[model samples]
Target: MSATRDLHDLGQSLWLDNITRDMLGDGTLAAHISDRDVTGLTSNPTIFEHAVAAGDAYDGSIRASVEAGKDGEGAFFDLALEDITRAADLFRPIHDKTDGVDGFVSLEVSPQLVRDTAATLAQAKELHARGDRPNLFIKIPGTPEGLPAIEEAIFAGIPVNVTLLFDAKQYLAAADAYLRGIERRVEAGLNPQVASVASIFISRWDVAVKDSAPEGYKNRLGIAVVQQAYVAYLELVASARVQRLLNEGARPQRALWASTGTKDPEASDTLYIEAFASPLTVNTMPEKTLIAFADHGKVGEPLARDGGDSEQVLAAFEAAGIGVDALAERLQQEGADAFQKSWDSLLEQIATKSQALTA
Candidate 1:
């Protein structure tokens, strides 16, 4: 059996972290689903920026949107929706078979609106409606400003993939937002089965501390942090609070490992994927990482529910002067900034491509 299948059979979903029109046109996305066990996908500003800028694959669509008098975010979403909804259809079978537990494709809300709760909600609802696919998740950042929007979006029956979470605390905050949304639904006599995932970013921890960390700690911090979060995830899923919701027909918001692509080239390409392997969670891999893992990814023993040595490992980093809690905030902020930058770039790319396609 393929190691990718092994990972999936072990109960962790393998989701592709990249999407482009070419991937769809070339049948690569569908092939990834069938051959690599990539049951889901997640896209971001960076991914779209790269996709639109890299080639003429999107040029025809850009021309159509431009001709329709769409520009900037409107044109961009038109392009994004076409790609995502098609990808969503590809996964719909799995989505139906699993009863909404898997087979999701995510599109992030405008990063520029992350801090504006009202704007974020408006854009989120708009984009979700635009996609119009039951398996499509409108991604919202897990920033403080994003929390209320996350809750409101879920309460409105929009599935969310909460992005940019850096630590267990951030993950829990996103979960709370999801819980509140479900709770409100139950009280209002709505279905409480809105699906969601709290995407905790890995690898960024190590990237952030790479220069400061001792050699012995070089690539270990990210795994340790995610391990700690996994412990919290176990507790959260088993908590009576969530159980009460389950009784009300709510599905527990799952934990997802983002940024699983290794930044440090010297480290094993599959470092995060192999280490963060735990049942009932997800690991969204970049195409490179997914290909690498499929080639030789070993399913190591799954992460211990108690987070074996996670606290101790984190303590060692603390002793080394890494203030994790503070760093988590910084990383989250940095992530939002980075997404905004990517969003700006995506708009510019779309504008450039539109002009070129029209001219």
Candidate 2:
């Protein structure tokens, strides 16, 4: 069996961290679902930016939308929604079979709204309503401003993928937002099982600390962070508060591992994927990483629930003058900014392409 199948059998979801019109039209996404056990997908402005910039696949659609007077971000979302909606339909079956636990496709709100809680929440509602797919998740950052937006979005019954979280604290914040939203739903006498995932980016941590850390600690921070977050995740699920919510018809918000692709050339290609395997969690991998794992990846023992040695390793970093708490905040902020840049570039790309196609 392929290692992708192995990971699936081990109960960790394998979601492609990408989507494109070509993948949708060429049946590549469907094949991944049918043959490789890929059950879900995630997209961001960067992914869509690359997709729209790289091909003629979007030319006709761009022309049509441009002819209809849609331009800039407006034109971009229309094109993106078309692709995401189609991808959502392709995954709809697994969504139905899994009762909405699997087969989710995520669409991020404009990264430009990352700092405005009200606008973020408003856009999330609009996008969720526009997508109109049961398995769709609105992607929001776990920034301070985004926390309230996440809570509001979830309370409004929108499934959210909380992005750009870098540590246990960020994950907890996102989880708390999810719980608050669900609790509000319970209070309002609505069903509280609105789905959500807190996406903790993995490899970026290692990349951030690579030059600062000792040789032994190289490429290890991301896995240790994941282990620590998993411990928190287990505690959350078993907590009285969450258990009560679960009894009230709510589901525990899942912890997702993002940025799982290896960033260092010297590192094992499957380092993040092999290290972060756990049931009920997700590892959203890039297409290259996904194909590599399916081709030659090995499934290792699952992560220790108690976060074995994570504290000790983190202590070493602390002793070495690495302040993880401060770093997490910085990383999350930088991530949000990076996405904003990508989103702006994406809009520009769409504008350029649409105009050229029309011409």
Candidate 1 least-lDDT 10 residues:
350-359
Clashes of each: 0, 0
Candidate 2 lDDT score at position 31: 89
What's the lDDT for residue 318 in model 1?
A: 91
Please provide, for model 2 over 111-192, each residue's C-alpha lDDT reduced to its tens digit, 9 standing for 90 to 100. 9888899999999999999999999999999999999999999999999999999999989989999999999999999989
The per-model lDDT (C-alpha) reads 0.93, 0.91
What shift in Å separates residue 237 of candidate 1 from its native position after superposition? 0.6
RMSD of 1: 0.9
Give the candidate number with the greatest lDDT. 1
Task: Give per-residue CA lDDT, model 1, range 252-294, as digits (tens).
Answer: 9999999999999899999999998889999999999999999
TM-score per model over all chains:
0.98, 0.98
